[model samples]
Target: MSRVVATTTLWRPTGPEELALVEASGWAAWPPRLPEQPIFYPVLNEDYAIRIARDWNVPASGVGYVTRFEVEADYLARYPVQQAGGRTILELWVPAEDLQEFNQHIVGPIEVVHEFRPQA
Candidate 1:
């Protein structure tokens, strides 16, 4: 069966002080919602794609490869679940044969966290 790998990048204010400021400003919602998990909104530029391809060791053409992104069960359980906010994590499904190749470029700081295989 084929499998899908989900990836995401997490960004936060640079320092605790910044975080405090963000909180104190009242701009930040109190008792943050569970579904408010961060989202990776890639601009999808040629150069960015190339970098991703290089990092994954796949050919540059692989950059535009479309992959489905969804939230994992655990994540849903932990965070407030909501369909809005593109906050769900990124996901990708690839043939089993391509798994190794994908893995080479996926694992690490990018947060390639889940493996989903189709049921027979």
Candidate 2:
């Protein structure tokens, strides 16, 4: 018999460059963080993801994308949820060193759910 695993949905706001790398991974994993980046933050709510993609990413990179994926709930329990700002701005901070293991816990393909681009 097969066992069912519990999963938690998470969203990440990313720019064109990072999205490209994600696609290059066949949508199965997130790219490794740059040396200066110490934490990989995946937000818990879509609204916050959307806001960051539209407001922060677009302005910085000319385009922004929101990707959603599910991770094993049990694996994710190791990290505490952090409040970045208001109550709804919740996120999970995965240390950069743990990203590889974190990626392994993803339940399925990472999907691009929304896109933002600068207005002409």
Candidate 3:
């Protein structure tokens, strides 16, 4: 039987220092293999989301596919500005079959974001 695995991450614009740090780290670039993009949403906090993405080795674009689960109303109140901007909670659906493989390899969501190019 297939089970749904939720991978999450926080995606905000990278600051200058963070960008520089990434460049200085000299990490190797990897080809995208995941069938879907990474998904970001309100249901998962930045910490949890980041953890899941790394665990799954999801690409930046693929991260868009992560779905929001168990989001609360009070959480919405915290983001009044986003609501004013008409930004609803974003969610992505990944096939349950893919979850196991991702969980096995990805240590966290930051690792997933690391795979994505800044411009791409």
Which candidate ranks first by TM-score, i.e. highest? Answer: 2
Q: Tens digits of per-residue lDDT for model 2 on 33-97?
A: 99999999999999999999999999999999999999999999999999999999999999999
Report the C-alpha lDDT of model 1 over 60-106, residue by residue, as the tens digit: 22222212223323323323323332434222223344333332442
Error of model 3, residue 120, in angstroms: 17
- Measured with C-alpha atoms, the lDDT of residue 52 in candidate 2 is 99
lDDT values for all models: 0.30, 0.96, 0.33
The global Cα lDDT (0 to 1) of model 2 is 0.96
Q: Write out the backbone clash pairs for model 1.
A: 34-79, 34-80, 35-80, 56-105, 68-91, 69-91
Worst 10 residues of 3 by lDDT: 63-72
Off by over 4 Å in 3: 1-5, 21-84, 88-120
Local error of candidate 1 at residue 103 (angstroms): 1.0
Give the C-alpha miss distance for residue 22 in model 1, angstroms.
Answer: 36
Question: Sorted by lDDT, highest first, which candidate order results?
Answer: 2, 3, 1
Worst 10 residues of 1 by lDDT: 60-69
